[model samples]
Target chain A: MESFNLFASLASAIVLEAAPFLLLGSFVGALFEVLVPDSFIERMIPKTVPGQLGFGLFAGMVLPTCECGVVPVVRKLLARGVPPATAITYLFAAPVINPVVLLSTYFAFQSDLTMVFWRCVLVGIPALVLGGVLGKGTAADILNLPKPVLRQMDDIRNENHGHDHGHECGCAACGETHDESSRIRAVLVHTGIEFLSMSKFLIFGACAAALFKTFTPSSVLDLMQGNNFISVGSMMLFAVLSSVCSEADAFVAAGFSMLPKAAMLSFVAIGPMVDLKLIPMFLSTFKRRVALALIVVPVVTIFYLCVLLAYLEGGV
Target chain B: MIMDRLHTILEGLTTALLGAFMYAFSISDSYWMLLSPKFQPLTATAGFLLFVTGAAMTTRKPPRNVRRWGALCAMLAFLALACWAVLGPESAFAPDPPKKHTPMSLELPEPGEGFEPRLTLNDKEYVRISTPELFALIEGTNKEYPREIAMRGMVARSPDLDKRGMIAVFRVNVFCCLADAVAPGFLVSVDDPDKYPQGSWVRVAGEVVESAESHANGEISLPGMLMSFVSLNHEIRGHDVRIIDPPDMPFTFEVRDKEPFAY
Candidate 1:
């Protein structure tokens, strides 16, 4: 396929696939806005080192919000007096450790319970450690989010007074200001808007993925065979560059069956926990130092573990 | 206030209408048309028309409750149709088949040994199979062939299989469609790994051997499948390769009562 045509096809497919996910995330994140009050979270967050780490890991399992999109909300929690450490933990853990990603992972990896269990353990460790460590600092001022963006915090807070017709479920940020009549308008408009906004990224990712799959020669992947430092390094780069969403990364990883198992495991571990597309959102929602620290620390730790496992296995 | 009230009614109408449409679509047989090029454009146009009409009705003063109800019903009908089309004959509550355990004796190279072949041999051909069924068959077919077992299937690479060779051949069986399909890969130790590229269907017959390795805990266990066994199982099933695609069913109840969402 011509580059242009490939791009177009991929763009459309990605958006369509990702639409439901993004909307679902948005709906659930908005509900978090309503159900869990800022003060409650602020009060509930742990104050000590181990407490912060434990809370961070547990939060990742329970929170269903997408990591990338959840950044803004997590940042909102931070601004609302929630601890920076807890907020940071939520940010990192939310993306990779959620129920949706877990379910998808279980299905994609041929229903391997062992793989699923290790995935959580391997990814969750750094999220807890770095999040708690990073929380100890006073770097919130470095984030530099605009005041107007910050005002969205209050927009959700005051929503209950503005619009009330019925359907007062108060379950979603969008649903909160809507009566029955307005609910249709909200769902339609929101769905349409969301579909348009996110379709581009989805399509871009899918098309590129499919094209890469069809065109990329086997030798390219073969080059990274074995557990040599270079091979592990190259595969890690591949995982990060693929930027496959956490939910879909396993299929792509599985597609590379010719590659070593340990390296493949590393790809599964690192890709979803951190990715290029999701980084900016993380930066937007958390302290820059904190985001940077969270991303770099977990990746480095997991990469080392992947190499160690391969080494111990005599080139798995 | 009037406009807000009107908008509210319209919003509810749209949600309720879309809900019903999604529900119906879940149960409808024409759901596959949603993926069809010819059908998608038509549906998109219809959706646009409804959206515009919806916009107009909401913009009007004191949005008529009747129109709102009509819109809600329409939206619901559309949603119902979408849902019906997407989910076909699959419900979560359906009773599962009884679990059966198979002893490793049937698959063992030696009748008394515990090793079992993951794929089943049918009419001297190896059929693609799941782990459980494969084991079950092994338990049932408790006799070692005097000769090597030969099976024919496609050669596709699978992560679950041992990834020692450059090209791994696998055979996949499609029960319904590619959506809910399973493929089991056989480990073939290729001398010239590059000669047989990925995605090639081949016939391979090999004596399976178990190799032991030490774990981090210092316990030794065999994890790798060695190709002590040998046979060139047919690489291709020439005439029967073509499988017909089933027509898309829109909204069949998913056997599991999970949230049924139309794709």
Candidate 2:
């Protein structure tokens, strides 16, 4: 009975929390597959250092998925020959530094566009730069997954046999091979499959959050308030442990005004990239080593910048 | 062919679901807040347009011209919602005003000493209030006022009473529907054990106390409740608070526009 109640609550929270974003994320992913030129993007990665960073950041802004929702999409983007650095930057920054998230963060902080702008710039810059520096034309096969899943996905894409997908001319270029009816069916099945896979993790995160709010003692937060290195470290740790989705993180950050801006920024920057919840998805989707390196370098760099800013501002 | 049909059905369903989500989010209902702020009035409008456009483009049965119209309308709707959220007067899209706390004087309910009135009334208790009630009476009073106040709300974060005779309190203030709903703090606890049990929506007639005590959550608490009278209805199961205008609106706007309220 107790287990049933937990399951019920978890289900309620997941449906409530994940439904909208999951729908939006999957829809956007499908749209990208349809509308975006995969081969064109593959050819666009500049060999220069700054160019790679810029492309990575740009990709992050254009892609609309949240941290939780971006995994599979990032994997697909990588598989299509987008540079590892670009893929990694997009993987980390897409959910955290996107236009929607940036605007929402500004609104949450009551139109502090400077904070919004700096956050994106600060996080996006380093993520792109570090990812570029690390990837540096690494071998591609190391990142590739088993052949079967790719083949199956390709088959589904080719079949394109669902809904009004039989009609060909109106949709994206991929519509040529498969009729409109098949394409619609393929997208639908793809979406449902993606939802089933990620919704459980989303449900777990929501339930954990709800439980934390209900049971955790408020006195515990006092340890996090301050401008010192300890405070920054604690906040980052809290961010990782909480595993909050990027969309909802600002509010949590706002609830604590004592934490320095740099630390707060780092928390937001690092949480989506390195948290335990997202790590599994990262490993499965990208090369585990590449994923780990991408996350670690950004987190460390962002943390140092946070401390530096706090020191300069005389916050601690 | 069968797979194609199933896929089409799924696409149609996806479009409908997205449209329904946007529609539901656009209306700020009373019970809950939508989790994503991106699902604002503008987003909903855009999503609707996108749904229509996506619907038009993907479906073979639709007329040829429908896709263009759908795309055009979707783009237009997206722009409109974006504008409204960014520039609309009702939006918290602008910078927040500086915080000012000039506690409005609120009328305090008579501090009944020896024996308190039963807060969870077994029967309906008739209480009276002045026709011209001062907002001051309720503003900062920590205790429940004896006034017959009619504040409709949904049970928010009403946690079960701990062994220490305290319960975590929370409520959802609705400017619209579940979407755009904001969770405001209205922490209530009783001096006497189990006096005001958790999840009970009562017209608390008391003074909002100024003294601070450490909360169960370990944060040094600033405000607390000192209830003089409480009237709760057992029939009000899952009593969700739906306040149109909460007494404190400063932070509410930000909360509403942030997660759990955004569509």
Leading candidate by TM-score = 1
Judging by lDDT against the true structure, name the best candidate.
Answer: 2
In candidate 1, stretches whose alpha carbon ends up further than 4 angstroms from where it belongs are A1-27, A33-36, A139-142, A145-200, A227-239, A282-291, A314-316, B1-170, B173-263
Model 2 Cα lDDT, one tens digit per residue, B44-80: 5644654553454345332212122232333233333
Model 1 lDDT tens row, A51-131: 866676667565555543555556566556566667666766776677767765564455676667767767777767766
Q: Report the C-alpha lDDT of model 2 over A146-168, residue by residue, as the tens digit.
A: 54566466457545533233221
Q: What DockQ, on C-alphas, does every prediction get? A: 0.05, 0.05
Candidate lDDT values, in order: 0.44, 0.45
Residue A1 of model 2, lDDT score:
33
The TM-scores, one per candidate, come to 0.54, 0.52
Q: What lDDT, from 0 to 1, does candidate 1 have?
A: 0.44
Error of 1 at A211 (Å): 1.9
> Which tens-of-lDDT digit does each residue in B32-102 have in candidate 1?
32222222333344344334434533443342222233324433433433343233322111111112312
